[model samples]
Target: MADQVLMELGDRLRVARKVEGSSGAVLASRAGVTQPTVSRVENGQRVSSVEAVERLIAALPLPPEEAERLTSMAREAYALASEGKRVDSGVSLVPDAARKLFTAASRVRGFQSATIPAPLRSSEYAAAAGADSDSGADWAKNLDDAGKSFEFVVTESALRTWPGSGESMPAQLEHLLTLAQRPNVSLTVIPWGVGLPVMPPHGFTVCDESGVLVETFTATMTLTGSEHVAAYRDAFEALAAVAVTGDEFRRVVEDVAADLTRFIQ
Candidate 1:
């Protein structure tokens, strides 16, 4: 998959250079980088450091507002890369470039306040929770196709309360168990027994590469900006740090299901 963030960064730089009517050598000389670095950056094959970006922005002689936007986008790309995350920066709710990235990209990192990621929501859970909007018939099928992988972190209480999940709860638990074993998915549970050392951040989804989708009670917000994406990426990584994975994590999920089984009896 193309690194959308980097590609955007490069495209922005090339545009700015063109608008300023400067050659690559001119920009490089002013930015203190080599002409080749400028060339590669314009081509999206190389990324400039944050400091270098600042220099490039200054050298672009772009209007102050345009320069800041360019630098901001570049910084976002660097931040994601530094954190070991990749972004295509093109994700969207519709069948566009972004949506294509969503389906084709290999990895997506996410954190949810509720149990189970949106794509994994059972038909019952989705209907009860009213999450069926925007995400259509392709939702479940897309996730199941499996060229993409996911790392999801959720709280244990999320599992305990599914408002409309009655008989579906058992199937839901079993569904999670099955998904957790899939090579493409990594599920982590933050058990109820532990307390967070700090106040928790809101939940967000880092769509493969450069997109972040966050929803509040009122409406949903999608962030394609680099800094916003980086912030959510950091947030997910922090939450994952405290989560339990592997056999112990699987056992926790199973125990929840087992308790539910007894409750059912």
Candidate 2:
């Protein structure tokens, strides 16, 4: 589990670097660390000092507050991993804080790189995903209600890949299609050919109706203040602009689902 936590953190770091249009070599150069150190840090093989984490955070597009939060998360993660615990599995500061943030949020915007959003996922898909333990039934209901207030953006790969926990690709894509028709839910797809401007990775950003919560396998980063929230909001909108919506989005999902069904046959 400690390894899981570390790897999760690493995944976030790697993805964030990509999202910022940076390479490990570039991050190392900016952070004043060796390229190997950067790779190990991003891979969760080595624990980073708070100061070192701060340096890397500074290099990212995050605000000071978020950078501090991430630095704190890294420190805590390092401590837990040293104790042979998964940073988020136990009743620790990270998971508790993440749950609170999720509960407190008035709205959410879940983005997926290659799977259906959990909030809209069906029982079949959820069961297939083996997501049983991490989140509970009440949490699912909260998301269901919150789904009325949240929006979502997914990439074309998510519709096609079924890379997340699920029974089958068709089931997941059908789930996406069903949720896309919901009255309060807005679903859009970033097509395959548009080309990602920043970087492509799997993750979600939540707007707490006031603040924002950014999740990675390692840390649950909270971003308060209107300025920070606005930045993510703008990004979501921009991504949505180039995406397909309404009938077009539905058609794409249907096609993907058909392909999956064919593969099964």
Candidate with the greatest lDDT versus the true structure: 1
Per-candidate local distance difference test: 0.69, 0.64
Tens-digit lDDT string for candidate 2 (1-265): 5557657767777888998898876897898765555666676664335466557777888767766777777777766655843434322234556556666777777677766666666666666655544342444566557344667888888776653432466666766677677676788888778855334354656655455566556555665544345545555655666788899888878877666766565
Report the lDDT tens digits of candidate 1 across residue range 73-147: 777776666674556343344424334445665677777766456666777766667663544334556666567
Off by over 4 Å in 1: 1-101, 197-201, 262-265
TM-score (C-alpha, index-matched) for candidate 1:
0.58
Q: Deviation in angstroms for 219 in model 2? A: 5.6
List clash counts for every candidate, in order. 8, 2
